[model samples]
Target: MGEIWIIGATGRAGRNISAGLRAGGHRIVLVGRNAQRLAEAAATIEASGGVPPRTLVTDDPLAEIAAGRPDVVVNTVGPFGTTTVPTAQACVVAGSHYVDLANEFQPVRSLLEMDSAARAAGSTLVTGAGFGTLANEALVYELCAGRPSPIRVRVAAMPVVDGLGPAVLASVVDAAATGGLIYRDGRLVRTRLGAHLRRIPLPDGTTRATVAVPTGELEAALRGSGAGDVIATSSEVPTGRMARAALPIVGAILRVEALRRTVIRLIDRWQLTPPATPGEVSWAYASAEWEGGETRQAWLQTGEGYAFTSRVAAMVAARLAEGDARPGAFTPGALFGADLARSAGATITLDSTTKDLR
Candidate 1:
């Protein structure tokens, strides 16, 4: 297999993806800003019985990609709003397939806009390999497969993560700055942040409050299901009544570019991260309704959020390294089909009343 270079190799997602790729028998190249940290991660990989991945320490990851010219680049760095376009462009220039754990709508759409360039360069660019987008998008694709355009689609991501890194928190702040977004009437629509809130069902026979956020799953669900109205939400965001009520104000404050940058810097400087409470599983829910009233719903069940993300990213990167992907920019589901989620350790269960298209 071709060498896979993982940017941000010292981060949680990067390390997990490296381990996963190693387990799949793929050679890895760990790239990070700190040589000692990169070496530590490489040692962990070696301890796992995989060959020690080559390490590269560089302040400019894109420069490293351009110079080293790895066959595939798995970018786990964020906020993707700043990194996705530049890294993807570099991948195109380097004739390297690119994949990222981008969940924000802006970055996802930005990457898709590079489809022609990626195709021209004969490289594949995939976004939203993480649980925040993939599991829900995959469920939407399966629920609407073989059906005509759907009138409405709803997707909710509920990840159970052991912990979150400062980068994850920074990404969330960046996404909030983009304001509210959705797909409605076959077009992009904007709304007040947290304009829609609902209690969504889960695989464990329970319900959790979810608030509509501008997640990449909105775009992916719309593309996969051809739905006129789509709402992508997540339990990862604060969903309490007060939190919902304050979302618009918070969003407005962050929308200012300078303020957004300041908040992100503060988060980074403080090393702010979400709590790490282990959970048994993570779940994603999707429901689609056709114009004629035919409806289908599905629940995707998987293990912890980071582990699932690692597997998904590794699978996509390994496939691209093995020449198994097409030369275009795509979401994971649109590119490889929903079944890819199953191969990455996600279990899909359709509603009993929904038609069995499989």
Candidate 2:
């Protein structure tokens, strides 16, 4: 069994992924800033009658990772904007595979851009191995398979998360600070934070409001479909007119370096209440259009967002540990094909006919 290290092992995502990997017979090392919390997290694994996990309490996880090269490292820390590059670089230096559940545009793009370095190091680096990027990017891959590069592609992430944590909120704040971005004629363009608001039709004959946001899904869609024009929207943001009008101003304020850091610090101490469950279904949608007006659409149906993210992250780590991935940087769907989503308990439906693609 491969030895896997989980950074931020005290966090919800980290704990879940650790349990999953351990159950799958891999040795786990729980790494975190808090010795007590890491011990507690390891205790849970031991209580499960699994191999007791090794706990490493350190303020500098990157340094530890570089020193003790595990087979794979799973990063559940955020805002990934700051953590992704340094952690992935540490993995490259240690010749260990890296995986993270990052879905921000900057972090995902930055990680993908390290393909040459990761390949040279003979280590794989995976970003966005989670609900938002994988769910939609998989559909984009499916829609564009065996077809010419599409002229336009639109993907929407509509995750229904059951709870919120301080880290998740911090990530949201980081994304808001990024404003809105879209690929137009194969170029990244910035716009208002809540621009391109649209209502997405669901498979259940309902419509949900979505607004364009700067997310990793946009970059993943662009790569998956080879589309010159790509837009990534999400139902996770506020969609009301007042909220939309205020988003740009809020984004502008958050762009200030000092203020953003202060806000994130405050968020770190927040005791957020878990949100009421949104239901059993979360959906991701993608549509692609060709130059001659031909179009294709697909939807991915899954359960709760966090659950799917944990599963996807664990699955990616397991595969990487098994040496199944090539030496490069990639998003999950790009590296493993669209079937990765299907294997992670998601069902894909295509077009108005609702043909099951699984």
Instruction: Report per-prediction Cα RMSD to one decimal.
Output: 2.5, 2.7
Tens-digit lDDT track of model 1 for 167-216: 88888988888888888798998887887788877667789778889999
In model 2, pairs of residues that clash are none
Question: What clash count does candidate 1 reach?
Answer: 0
Poorest 10 consecutive residues of model 2 by lDDT?
349-358
Q: Could you say which candidate leads in lDDT?
A: 2
Q: Which regions of candidate 1 fall more than 4 Å away from where they truly are?
A: 352-358
Which lDDT value does model 2 have at 1? Answer: 61
Residue 156 of model 2: what lDDT? 92
Error of 1 at 133 (Å): 1.5
TM-score of every model versus the real structure: 0.96, 0.97
- lDDT of each model, Cα atoms only? 0.88, 0.91
- Residue-pair clashes per prediction, in order, are 0, 0
